[model samples]
Target: MFFEILKNLRKKFKRLYITMFKNYIIFVFLMLLVLSGTIGFMIFSIGKMVSSEDYIKDTQKFFMASKIVKSDYKKIDASKIVASKGWVEILNSNKKVIYVIGTKKDKVTSYTENELLNFMDLSYNNLKSGTSYFYSVTAFNSNGEDLYCIVKVPPGIVTLNVDIAPSPDKYIKKAAIYILVGIFIIIVFLTVSVFLYAYLTTKKVVMPLKKILQGIKRMTEEDYSTRINFNAENKFGEIRDAFNFMAEKIEASIFERNRMENLKQQLLSDISHDLKTPLTSIMGYSKALNDGVVENDKKIKQYLNIIYNKSKRTVSLIENLHEFTKLDNSKFLISKEECDFCEFVREIVSEYYNEFEEKNFELEINLPEDEIIYEFDKVEMERAISNIISNILKYNEVGTKAKIELTYDNSKIQLIIADDGVGIDESLKENIFEPFVRGDKSRYTKGGTGLGLSIANKIVQKHGGTLTLEKCKKYKTVFRLKL
Candidate 1:
């Protein structure tokens, strides 16, 4: 269970790494967005914490003390609550936009005219109870014109006069609006700056990194000749060093593996060639002796006949081995010719009918009548196709059905080969196409030199196409070639 959990985590991380971190640009963009959001939030929160409420009790007290003088905690005056026309100050009223009164107590210091209306409303609501007495206040300057607050001591009908300049709430509100606007502008600028900085920071790293990654991926996909050069002298230079190191290691490993594999194959080829030449000469001599030299000598003729037969069998085995070995060496390249694909296939199938029939292979062929031309090496295609056909014939039971299909669409050519045979086992299906692996290991009737499919794969790859085993089941196997 622990191993399974670890495996699952590794898979998930691998997928995420492939899909997400493959692009460094996105990582930088996210970093910019997150940083800007955090800074904006921090600034806004600080502004709120230090914010002054506009017209709370402290503000009202300050305004009152600054405006109303001589009416501070003194005897209550009456009979002047609503005489109108500066009834409280009685023609000394001149403060335009009075902010506070010189009242003794700090009860109603910060009252403005607008707030005066609401305060008056509240006092009137209380005084409407027909109380015996109440108090009120009003504001003015030496030349009142713009603002004031008026309050009444109802029932007693006393009015209080105040004189002071307006508070800074109006200007402060404007300043708040302006500051909010400024913060908004800063937000926009910061957002842009963050992303720009991110782009500037990331482009230096990501662009070259992406180029290197693509080059490395191409090389891994077997384009060993692809050259990538990304030079830097900083951290990216170190990363470049690591990447070049990895690429060098991979290239060296692939080169060594391929070199050793080729050497093994060449050794097999040379050994087979040497064996085949001598066997062919021996078979020729035995055949000549049996057919022409020993005609009527019964026992010697019989011996020569056996010798010829055995030599022929031995030669056939040697040739088969040589063919398998040749598949391994794969140094032979094709001379491509542009030809109509369908016509080429039709001609090859027509020529190979007797070979298919001799194996009791039920053959089905399909090809388009359209004249689609492509460049291909006929020799390579024939060898690949023949190996597949041979596999079907050797591995399948007698009277097994086989199919060859050719279809083209969207400028792509598809070749499909299907056969009903004892398909690969579920356990070993993945490895069956590897060199030297046979579908059946219990016997050697097929002489399954496993190099056949491997060579076919390489050939198709040479043609810029892919060959894949589409399905393998108990009754059938299908091979697909897509170009």
Candidate 2:
């Protein structure tokens, strides 16, 4: 059950609505917002506590103002002996009420001096119930007589003892409004700061995602060359690098595929053109012989020879085509083994000695005497070597000297084949190793198929080696093989 839960968690994380980085930014912002709101409430609560204290002090001050009246209570005007939204009453030491002002005076006038004194000694709630008002008491001397003064404070203003001042309602309201505005401004400033931070931070995180989307769009349009050229200092940078690498690989793959397709079409066209001439001669001469159109024995023999030669050429062409196809398809594996490189070459060279003699060619062997053992596919390597020798035999004139030189470096085996033949033309040098590409236009009928160099090059490449036409001067041709 735990494993299942963990698996679900992993899946959720993989397909998360918000990335980890962006989610983290949002979480932090929410925390900051909560903190800002809490601080604002705290400030407002402190302001209210201070305001409540000021209200109690103001009530004490109103009590003091009421005591300032004389013992007779006639020196102060009844109208002036009042507070804003409050009333005042004075009593002599004899417990006789002096006067009452503001609000309903009947509640204060009914309270006996002893009764009010007892109420003042009780809790504030009892004091309000006895007088039916919220008021304060103070003792003072007027006309040399001790007196008790009661002053009623309005609900809107806090009772402060500092002075018999105006009602605090307007000032308190204004202060409360100012505090509220301050809290609102602080909240707005913090909100804007958090939102701005989130926007910039999220943009930084999501920028790479946008680039990835753009890259994918370009790829869908078959533009493999599109690459994200960003070097960021984060995990997204690794993603960008991987994306560029993939684009390069895909581009290379497409290029190679297109090149192979073109090669296939060219191969088909060349085959058709090459086969037509030989097939025509074979059919024509065979038809003549079957119709008894050639009466004499000598003429019939000549016709038969012509047909046989054409058939042989056609068969050779078909075999070469099949071999070329097998090599291109990447299905054939090289049978590799360890052997002495020098001995292998000597054996293949000895087989070609008779051909060299028949062509009136001089054979030269320049090989290092070192016994160099190398791993290679002997059959394929020999076939490649034979193709090169066959070209020498077919293209070079009589009395042309052919040289086979073998040498080695620390990392490779080098085979150099040079011949004083009718060398390749400069125009053909660029595409000398392409199939069915012949030089001078004369080698087509000189018993050459024009695929010799191409096949040899492919074979050598499969052995993890390279073969190239090193030089093709006027009468000098050199092909270099490296393994």
What TM-score against the true fold does each predicted structure earn? 0.44, 0.57
lDDT by residue for model 1 over 141-222, one digit each (tens)? 3332333444333343232222112255664676566567656766787688779767865676567667766875786586
Local distance difference test, each candidate: 0.60, 0.74
Tens digit per residue, CA lDDT, model 2, 1-483: 323533543454365445765777877788678767767675776567556755555433434444344555556443533545666676767666666655644543456657777746754333332344456666777767788767665534443232434466755676677677766776787788779877855665567678866886897788989898654665566657766777788899999899879978988888998899899999899889889888999999999898889899989989888877788778788888999999999999999888888888888898888888999988878889999988888877899978899998886899999987788888998888999988668898886777878889999999989998866452378899999
lDDT of 1 at 146: 34
The regions of model 1 sitting more than 4 angstroms off are 1-332, 424-428, 446-448, 472-475
Q: Which stretches of candidate 2 lie over 4 Å from their true place?
A: 1-204, 357-364, 398-402, 420-422, 425-431, 472-477
